[model samples]
Target: MASAVKVLLIDDASLIRRLLGRVLNQDPLIEVVGEAENGQEGVELARTLQPQVIILDIEMPVMNGMEALPLLKKAAPKARIIMFSTLTESGARATLDALSAGADDYVTKPSNTGSFAATAGQINKQLAPMIKALAASATTYPSIRPHAEPKAAQQTVPDADHSWLTVTSDGAPEIVVVGVSTGGPQALQTFVPALPADLEVPVLIVQHMPAMFTRLLAERLDAQSAVKVGEATNGQVVKPGEVWFAPGGEHMYVTRQGENIVLTTDTAPPVNECRPAVDPLFESAVENFGSRVLGVMLTGMGNDGLAGSRLIKSVDGYVIVQDQASSVVWGMPGMVAKADLADQILPLNEIAPRVVDLLSTPRNRK
Candidate 1:
């Protein structure tokens, strides 16, 4: 028989420890090797148990998940750490901070005490497959290199000679479509907040996330962006200076009504194994807007957006992909680059400015 995946559970509450243990133990592929009621103890147990995975709670006593994460990494560098956080503003902020601090992923805790069955179902549904995939990929070998930057320009517009913002079309884009996953939360935190408040086009976003997490993510982005960011509702109007996120477990598509666009949500089967898949959103944007569309694929895992990018290119629409060096997993954007679908591939830090420049160009107005 195959060996089980060794897991270590860390949390401050006894009830959480018991509940998590019960839930995880139900999986024949997973075996709980150790447990801790605090971050300091969790770190020590992680060092000793050397489990394959660690489910960490951020609100633990003694060290807290953020403070203990680096130490745990040092002690067991190969073990993947998944933070368990509450579904609140503070929890969202802390979870993002944990990711920046090197946690692999996160899951939300159950809101009510009696919701163990539902929470366990969600956890198993979301994480088990991801963990299995990560385990399989962990054995692969590849060394990554640092990205080379273009030489500085003499004028205010840096690298103007090699700038990727050239307009190839003769009209204003009719739609703006964005794709993101994996380390998208951090990327969005940096890029979306920088967009101009008076942006004159409708924007649609597809970010890979679970249902409850998307709501929290939308709330966080709305708090930061000049644009009104919110979870996409069925049949909502897509307007200027407002950004709509594809709700988890549903695909978001665009349809036109006169000169305006209407956002639609559907429960169609998962595409590319993701419900709010980037491909559907991208393809829908192409169908609805044709040559007057801008497709941007950001940092993410897997090849979810490449096919859609090709569709956009076939219609003479513009495509921009995040460069590999700035990506967390480099799967989605790398696929676009490898397929030669991207008009330009840029670093994460440069993407927002590049977008602004693209939109603000005189040629963009046709």
Candidate 2:
């Protein structure tokens, strides 16, 4: 018989430990080998159990998940860690920190405890496939080496004289659309916080994640950015100096009504194997905003945004892709570059400034 996947659950709450343990134990393929109520204890248990997976809670009293992650990885390099975080702004920031520190995946702690009985069912449906895939891929794929910080590129804009000051009626873009996955949290942390506070356009983002993660991501972004960032709600008017992110398990698209653009969400068929896929957002931009859209594809693990970039190009919308050397996985943006869908391929460090420069230019009129 095949050996079961051993799991270690670590959280401060006894209720959560019992609940998650009950839920995870239901899976014939997964066995809960151990449990820890704090990060320090979790680290010790991890060394002892040598589990195939560790479910780590971000907020712990003894040692936080972020701090424990590297130590845990050092102790058991082969163990896959799945961070469990609350659906809050602080929780999102901590979760992203854990990911950067080496957590393999994450899940949100459900707010409704009454729904605890169904937790395992939901987690298995969403995470089991990813875990299995990671396990299978690990045998063939070498572990990721730490990537160096990317150096910024210095490229002179064509219309350098007019780049900073020119804002013509024809060149003023109304919306900025962004798409990312995989290494997005880190990328977003670097990108979104750097955007100019006085930016004249509204930004729409679709980061491939679960529903709970997206909400937390938006809240975290909102706290970090001068511009308002929040989960996209149906019929909400798109406004400048604000950002609306695609909700998880749903597709977000833009629609124009009179002079205003409104955000809409739906249970649309999954595109590119993601409900909040980048293709629909880009496709919708082409149909709704036409030449006024600026589409950006960033670091991710798949070609989810490639077709979308092509669609943006079809309608004369400007498309920018993050260069392969700067991407964590180079799957999404690399696809756009390979297909020649991008107007320019830039490093992550240069992408935001280039965007600001492009939108600031008068010659690239809509």
Point to the candidate with the largest lDDT.
1
Across 1-366, the per-residue lDDT of candidate 1 in tens digits comes to 767788889898888888778877888887889999888998899999898888889987788999899999988888878888887768877887787678777777876657887868766776665554344335432443222321111122222122322223456676789999877887888888887898878778899876766777888889988989999999999788888899977999998888768999999999998989998888778677766788888877788988788777766677788876666667788777776667777788777776666666725422
Best by TM-score: 1
**What TM-score should be assigned to candidate 1?**
0.73
lDDT of 2 by residue, 1-366 (tens): 656688888899998888877876776777889999988998899999898888888878979888889889977788878888887767876887787676766777766766764776666666565444334333322223222321122222232131222111244566889999866877887788778888788889999986767887788778898878899988989888788899988999998899998989999799888889998888777677665778888877668977667656654567778876666556787777776667777779887787787678835422
TM-score of each: 0.73, 0.67
Please report the TM-score between candidate 2 and the true structure.
0.67
